[model samples]
Target: MKFSQSIFLPIAAIALTLSSASFADNNQRRIDIDSKVVTEHKAKINNQRFSYTVATGTQPVWDDKGDAIATLQYTYYTRDKVDDRAKRPLLISFNGGPGSASVWMHLAYTGPRVLKIDDEGYPIQPYGVKDNPYSVLDIADIVYVNPVNTGYSRVVEDKDGKLLSKAEQKEQFFGVKADIKYLAEWLNTFVNRNERWRSPKFLIGESYGTTRVSGLAHELQNSQWMYINGVVLVSPTDIGIKRDGPIKAANRLPYFAATAWYHKALNANLQAKDLDELLPEVEQFTINELIPALAKGGFIADDEKRRIIKKMAQYAGLSETFVEQNNLDIPTQFFWKELLRDRGQMVGRLDSRYLGIDKRDAGESPDYWAELTSWLHSFTPAINHYLREELNYKTDIKYNLFGNVHPWDRSGNNTGENLRLAMAQNPYLKVMIQSGYYDGATNYFDAKYTLWQLDPSGKMQDRLSFKGYRSGHMMYLRHADLESSNTDLREFIKAALPKEGQAAKY
Candidate 1:
């Protein structure tokens, strides 16, 4: 889970209601839910020079009574002097945390600007922004939206200049269903306002944002009557897939093997084989052998259990005794701690490549997330400076890297099935998943499993694709994957666009 900002709002004002007093001028209190600031800029992306206009602003989120209840902050980038605006592709991007800002993707992934991190993604000195050489801006117009209470986004006072009741806040914007519901409506208004109704539309989200976009796929089609061309899920969650008991236990092996291989902790023969070669063998064992053995549990024969234990130890780089003691269900934390215990360090949860030192090596999990702290160190200053200096969107509001969105309702998460239903209904719709091989939280193989479960009948298999990377959760942070992932995205967008005069039929 992401950390919350220390500042807490009153229960009645939990919607992150902005005070009208903040915008006061000449002692006249006012509010502007639909204000904006525009700036012109130029960048060379993919070796192509282009002038672009960035509109950084807030758009109103209206309530059922035709009143604005909240304002979502968004930054949109459009190539200037485009001859045919209707034909351009518009990519809507978001990052996860349920409470996270859209900063990750905005400054580190697909946007024209990226952090000044090292080639391998560690924070560098004099942290700042640089032109992204691999941005997809040449092929698509992009918008990064911050949900309520994230970045500069905030819920607003009601018609009477009073904060909404707690019930209204929860019912409006704080749960799985509610989050998707409002965001779909918000997109509808955004498209209408920007006259993007005729453009080829795509949604790209990472982590919990995967659930957001997945549910939005169905919600937009069913509720808002808006159809999208493609959906990209990066380092995706299960998206509400049911992976209980044996299935869950078996799924962790491939990730363990990948992380182990990266750290060179595997046995000599397994280490000798390339990761590409070793993973298939482990995956085959996981699906064909491990899942079944785990399903048998205590009922399994002694010899079969011992054999499974040995294979698991070899692949996982753990002692067979420990595997046996855990009864074949090894916790991921234990794996992270135990993997490099001899070296007096622990692996990161999000990216195993990053190492951390613990106070004592006696814990099941590391003292902290080695990757997240490093990310915040680099991302915080970069985004804060970029918004004010480059974009010229001035505001005194503190940008919450991770806002207060707890008591977040996780119920009714049927987004995976929802995406399936959306695909079934919209013949023009296609899906692509991007995963990092070293992402332990939402491992790569489980993403493939989500793909498999999404279309069990394999009817839309042709429209589905999966791409894996060598880095962790935010794979694009690495220089090589940055170039390759953007290329994959460009290809996917072009492939998903319907041919001229083509029918939306199977």
Candidate 2:
């Protein structure tokens, strides 16, 4: 899974005390299925009163030969009193971790209720959740799915009641192709079981989930015969050309400038300009001067290299001498540490506005990411409480918020190519890409570069739209960005709707 630098942390083993007797008896193992919980609720969103039904449970995932392999946990919210199911749209959502639960997006902004964090997205003690007035529930019915091994989802025993070993389970759903295959199958099962085949289907994925949706789009259309109407990507990664050489460094320049501007570290003239204006200038410099200079390397004249370094310092908010000493290549980690080193602090790689106090001020990297810790503290407890208390779902299993599913096989994982193919196969498919200005994980500029590469002919440009937020990776954590994102999504969904008498047929 592609993650932001800060999001990937050490995985502590969850204590699951299973008896030796139970482990020894393979035939005694049986499939455990939780009862589905259904509740009716009403909320006033955007000043409009809406009633919806919330269903929380697990759906069985079956293999090709009619054998159950995994059970995926999900929370589905469907608006009540919708006469024609065919007319309403259905959105399937998930977050990335390759092992992350869907709780972040579910409880933060997309679901009917959102966790009550501070305006700046910092956690408040005694974490609580309330009706999210900006939720997308008003526009479409949503299903927040926690992929296998995350949340309450788990691999199950075979039809013969024989449990598969951990290695076997990993072989089934831990790789890029296997993950998409199972998810696509699970989606098919859900839509069929719920009688939502005629409804226009859409997908919303964040971070690595973006990569999942891009690949799933093609997989669904080609393998499962399921055509989707739209896909909404938040903090997308793996869409652009591989981040290496001068391209990688070039893609990061805008983020550096944004980080510098946020900290007021840029030169007086650059700092005086509005972010909208300053970013374009930085982007121009990166493409016209910085990229070319980096490509030429030592072949470039000494004077030109010196001039480029000085200009880079002006935009990146670093000293000319410091930039020169590094040979004009400043990685993101170094920038995070060096940006605020003078004050004995480090900026967060996930969100540059967040400041952290390092144990040692002279280190190349901070000890930990303050922003990630802050979010985990709030989200972890809030999700647990909401699931048990309000949702009425009972589970003794420790929810795997971010499981240890690393060393993931990335072979044949060209999601950008998959997206392009999906678009070509289904010309009516629309896409929306959302990015946060302060997100160092997947830079907004890098996403744009990926889009540029996706549509070289510009024929599908009108169907593709981009929205920017003034927040970080989890942009919706900020209330204002949440509102803005919800509004833009509402518009995008409306625009993506089929024209009069042109509804899609599955």
Candidate 3:
């Protein structure tokens, strides 16, 4: 799980509250809810001027008995004077970190204003924000949603206006199934309230957000009768924990080669080739040699083992002896440290192009990811400024950019299965998976493996497509990749929508 800043409250203080009858009856209590804050704004996309409305606020989630259980916070942007909801698409976007807020996706790429940073996404002194000419607002109405407990979203107070205890809040909204249940309910409420029943709905999620969207597609279909047109997965990580063996190791080979190629750590022949040229050779080697060799385990001959070690060293930028010592399988974490150990530095797991200095270079993992630090530095303040100063939505609660949703229950959930079922149920539902070539966290090849596992028959293969960027997990942090990604997504959205006369298939 991603490390995030959190506030820890003593369990003893809330122990009595947990035992009290008042706490038990709190769910039965009724409370008056407030309306969301809506504001108007103007922006230019593709050098064309357009006016939009920014609605920043929370929507109450009510239970079957009509009591408010939780409130989900969102920043919604809709084009003004667009009367035909059926023609305009609505894209609901979110970030990962089971605990992360939606601010990363909101301010960094999809929203009207984007954070200003260096070309490679490093933080610049005197941080600034700029208008995003590639904003999706030109084609789709965007709603950036923060799951309950992230951003300004929280559980509704009791009739007497008393907030629930931390334990109670966790019980309500912190697990896999629980999260899907509540988010599906919240989306249903938002659609009914906004009268977006006819809009071509799409979901865009990054990292764990991809996991959420996968399950959400199924849940929304069954529970809310909501069928989506498309889903955009950014740096997806839906491979289940049970499937982590030789296949996982094999899947990571291309990523290791890509990272080594980026830092010029590969052999002279590999170094001379571009990343595009080097990765295909590594991927072929992985399937034809590495997976079979690793699957053989101790039974392989010594010469064969030596040959595998040499090839691994060639692709992974490690010594033959080091690769042999690790049983010819170099885990990604070890590669992070080993690849640049001679230079007294460690490469980042999120983005291998990012280098960081460790206190001691002998450790298995780097001290921290430099890219994550750069992201937090730029996104945190930018979101706070946008919410309060620009949109004028004031709140005393500290925005949970990254909250404490640890011990996250990851049980009995497979979004790939959900994705498959959704596509089978709704034939027109298309999927677009985007990945960063330099990202070590969720390798592009691994994402391909996951998608391959989903569709073995090639029947729905045409419905799925992929695009790779020369970036890390958050590819949009870089300018060139951001522009390319916007264009790619725009084309995908246009293709996924129904034709003018034909009704939405969903």
Candidate 4:
């Protein structure tokens, strides 16, 4: 529900209309669930030129009876002529949306190809991809995965050539646990078939995919006996970490300050300070002063309550009266709408740097998301062009950009604990979190909180690290972040790998 604003938009009116012929092709021209289309390519990454083979294909997800129920589409990139690939690391990448396709990271971030967007992360007229010199391919092979109902991934027909009922499909692949379970099994098959069981493996996920990979970290280890070396969470979700009401409310202040600072809406003194200088002060106040004040609720004295409101208003770039009117708790939507109300504009939920105009300037929230539309304008066309024209994987089946994967069961979400448990079991496992300061959807402060709570015993603290960017949810979209983020990943991968004679013991 936290990520529903960006990933889980309503799709009741759009009919699925997925044809069975798309899957059961006899001509061998169209792609099927059990198909593999290999292509060769070259790219210059990190100033180093190299050729790599891209194996774009669909792998089946089998049921308990060993029957294929669904297929997941994936693109794997491995450097060419690597005689000792067993020592090379493989990075398995996923984008969040519970229902959104993997195209975001596939075309924008760590992929060898990047969308032709501007340096500041805006769409351009010519929608296509260019060589990503910052891609981490120089150090590690990468694979981008599209889960069920996303991208070209779809439900498979039964042995009788009939699609399974809608109810059955949801039961198998449309929930937190269900998603983790099937993907782990599918990964086991992928590792075995590729003969890379000895290769060091890593998992990287964004947004809701963070939840998916966090769960998968434990699921793959415990269920399939697949041990991974590292886990990277980009613009992470709560991963089932519990935050009480007052704590949640107090945690939002630093994000408000960051967004306000980006818009130049903060007070003159606060606005003059750099983001790095400003955030720590706000963060200190939020933890030491605000959280306790909020917990007192109506029991606090009037003078104390008034003092808290003034500071909240000052930090959030809102009027004292407005902060007081909201009972000292501001909803993110309301902040998005009210931030630029006088200018007749609204900030984006995912990336506040993008602005939107509402039908009326008096609304509580904007009419639609500004950042998502901007993202689609570029990503949709570039991915379509790159996959078909460059990669040469052709198919008539329409790619579901943001698939209809709702009625998504969010129960039993203990994935945060699962990651901790997984780390406790595997001493070699390490984690790195990347978050954007301007990402209102999954605020950077909450990401820090999630990491802090991930291992309460503090034993795994040394294995964990956090990195912050100045952009939003998809931080790599910005040209500056693209370079630095990949560099961080390169460093993380190298550090997480064990020394030649090192043991896997604490």
User: How do these models rank on lDDT, best leading?
Assistant: 1, 4, 2, 3
Cα lDDT of model 4 by residue, 1-506, tens digit: 01011111112122121335544556543336666667677777888877888877777888898877788889898898888989999999988888989999888999888889999899998788888888899999998889998999988776676777878878888999999999999999888878788899999999999999999999999999999999999999999999869888888899999999999999899999999999999999999999999999889889999999999999999999899888888999999999899999999989999999999999788899999999999999998897776676777778888887888989999999999999999999999999999899999999999999999999889999999999999999999999999999999999999999899887
Global lDDT of each candidate: 0.88, 0.81, 0.80, 0.88
Off by over 4 Å in 4: 1-31
Which ranges of candidate 2 are over 4 A from the true structure?
Answer: 1-31, 159-161, 503-506
Q: Write the per-residue lDDT of candidate 3 for residues 1-506, one digit (tens) a residue.
A: 11112222222322222113224444453211333566677788867687878777767776666666666778899988887877799999988899999988788777788887887788776765778888788899999998876888767665555676777666667877778888898899899878899899999999999888988888898889999999999999863533477887778878988888888998798899988888889989998998998898899998998888889889988898888888877788888998989999898888888898999978888888877886788888888887876776666678999877776878878777878888889876899989999899988888877777777678888889999999889888888988888888888999998776765444
User: Which stretch of 10 consecutive residues in model 2 shows the poorest summed lDDT?
Assistant: 1-10
Candidate 2 per-residue lDDT over residues 1-506, each given as its tens digit? 11112211111122121223222453543224433666667887777786777777777777677666667888999988888888899999989988899988899978878887998898898897877888878879999999887888877766465666768777778877888888998898889878999898898999889988988999999989999889999989865347678888777888889989989998789999999999889889988888999999779899999899888888888888878877788888888989889988898877777898988889777788878888888899899998777766655678889976766777778887888889878876999999888888888888777777876778788788888888888889888998999988888888888897884433
Clash pairs of candidate 1?
A: none
In the range 1-506, model 1's lDDT, one tens digit per residue, is 11112222222222223434434442533334676677777778888887887888878898887778888889999988899888999999988899999999899999988999999999998989888888899989999999988998887776566766778788888899999999999999999989999898999999999999999999998999888899999999989998889999989999999999999999999999988899899999999999999999899999999999999999998899989999999989999999999999999999889999999989788899999999998999999998877776666778878987777999999999999999999999999999999998999989988889999899899999999999999999999999999999999999999999998888
TM-score of each: 0.94, 0.92, 0.91, 0.94
Q: Is candidate 3 or candidate 4 better by TM-score?
A: 4
Ten-residue region with minimum lDDT total, candidate 3 = 1-10
* Higher-ranked by lDDT: 2 or 3: 2
Clash count list over all predictions: 0, 0, 0, 0
- TM-score of model 3 (CA atoms): 0.91
Off by over 4 Å in 1: 1-32
